[model samples]
Target: MAGRLYLVPAWLSEDAPVESVLPTTVLERIRTLNDFVVEDAKSARRFLTACGHPGPMRDVAMKELNEHTAARDVPDLLEAVRAGRDVGLLSEAGVPAVADPGSLLVAAAHAEGIAVVPLSGPSSIVLALMASGLEGQRFRFLGYLPADASERTKAILELEKRSARERETQVFIETPYRNDALFASLLESCRPGTRIAIAVDLTGPEESVRMQAVEAWRRKPATIGKRPATFLLLA
Candidate 1:
């Protein structure tokens, strides 16, 4: 039988300790996996160390899987699992394959009939949605919005309309550095009464999740700076 493919989740914030966000059981299973496909090998190594991996760091096997990884090269990363050696798939943060590049590897594992198991851990997206006070029954995660200002504004407007028409909540994320610009576009493009939720620094000491009308937000504008944040809109 082919070895299993484990989808391991990382902590929401780099500043957080592994024990705080991940259960002991998951960390123990992680230590047993020798091969890994990760968004950043260096970061994965650091995470493993923090989780109390017993082996020497140099002995662990890891392969890079990020935006720079080519589609044609994805299949090669799963060879170890196909050969009956369990492999772990880890992301830079949060869950693997959820808005992360590891999804390609997961797809390849499924295509090859490998058993993929997802371990429980902190997810900034799900954490944000659960705390946003928005309609959780029906919602959509739009991933990262367009980089261009005009296109982003257009997307904000379209998602807002969808929220109102379907009574669904819209969730999205931004590069920490571009969070300010995205917040501005949301305030400017969304209707005044449309509800907006901002969840920032999730699973960190300074975590904040607030919900308010766009009009109210205009009165007391917030500067998100470079903190990671998730935005939810319900119209």
Candidate 2:
């Protein structure tokens, strides 16, 4: 029988209690898997330890896969699964394969006809959307914006336009350090009447979620600082 590919979720906040976000069943499933394809092995080990995994870290088989991982090499990460040994795919944080690189491995598993199982847990995107007070019925997650200033501004404007026309919510994230820059871009590029939502440090002690008009946001600017955040807009 072919083994399964368990898409395990990790903690969003390093300091949050494991049980708070991860259910007992998910933890138990995590403990059963000895082979894993992880975005970061060190963090994966730490997460396992925090989950009360009984086995020694050294005994676990880990394969690293991240932005640096080549596409051609992704299939190799599923070797253990092909050999009838269950493998887990873990992200550095949140659920695996949503906006994560683990999607490559998951796609490989599917191509090979392997069973892929997803365990329930915290997903910052989902959590943020639930709290954003935006239109949950029609929303699109754009992941990240372009890196260049002009391109990013263009992307923001285009997304805002889409939000306005479709009455759909546009969701995207930014690097923690660039949170302020993205916030500034949104204010500059969006119309004054556009509804904007900011969800910061989700599941962390500093968690904050707020939604308001672009004009109101400008009147009293939010100190996004260096915190990780998700941005949503509806015009």
Candidate 3:
């Protein structure tokens, strides 16, 4: 039988899931997951060390498969599958491949008749929406706003219009540094009553989910884009 492809989920806390493995039944699962495919091998190793189990650096294999990863490297992931390696792909934070890397590996795995399993836990997008105070029943996740300020503003206005017309929550993320500009654009584009949610450092000690009417946020002085964040706009 082909080896298992375990997609493990790390916690939002600095202490990774490996620490949770000691609490009881989680230990069994930890033993089963001996191999890993992480987006940031260095970070994973650091987290594991922080968990009080400093393992070898190579314990988690990473072939630079990221947003900037070349399409050619997609095949290495397949080669690993044929070797019957049970690799666990993880994102730097939150869920893997949800606006993170791992899709190439997944697609490659599928093409090679290997299994792809998704281990769920904290997803910033879902968490943000749940606390967004928006119409969660119907929502759309727009991965990222354009880098160009002009186009970014256009996307904000268009997303707001979508929420107004369809009553759907439109979600997107921005580079942490660009978050303030994105909020500025949102203030100028979205309707006054349109709802906006900015979830920051989710699941971390500094986690905060702010919900406000677009108009009020303007007066309150926006507080997004300074830290790692996920943005949601609701009609």
Candidates in order, TM-scores: namely 0.97, 0.97, 0.87
After superposing candidate 2, which stretches have Cα over 4 Å from the reference? none
Better of 2 and 3 by lDDT: 2
Query: Per-residue lDDT of 1-235 in model 1, one digit per residue for the tens?
Result: 6999999999888787888899899999998988999999999998888888886989999999999999999999999998899999999999999998788999998898899999999998899999999999999998999999999988988999999999999999999999999999999998899999999999998999999999999999999989989999999
Residue-by-residue lDDT tens digits, candidate 3, 1-235:
5665656565565733444323333234434454666777777766545444434555645555677788777767655556777776767776676677677777777777788776656677888889878888999998989999899878888888878899898989888898988888888888899888899877766788989997899898766646778889887
User: Could you tell me the lDDT of residue 57 within candidate 2?
Assistant: 93
- RMSD after Cα superposition, model 3: 2.8
Off by over 4 Å in 3: 13-32, 50-54
Q: Report every candidate's CA lDDT.
A: 0.93, 0.92, 0.73
Off by over 4 Å in 1: none
Query: Which residue pairs in candidate 2 collide?
Result: none
Please provide, for model 2 over 66-129, each residue's C-alpha lDDT reduced to its tens digit, 9 standing for 90 to 100. 9999999999898899899999999999999999888999889989899999999999889999
Query: Which candidate model has the greater lDDT, 1 or 3?
Result: 1
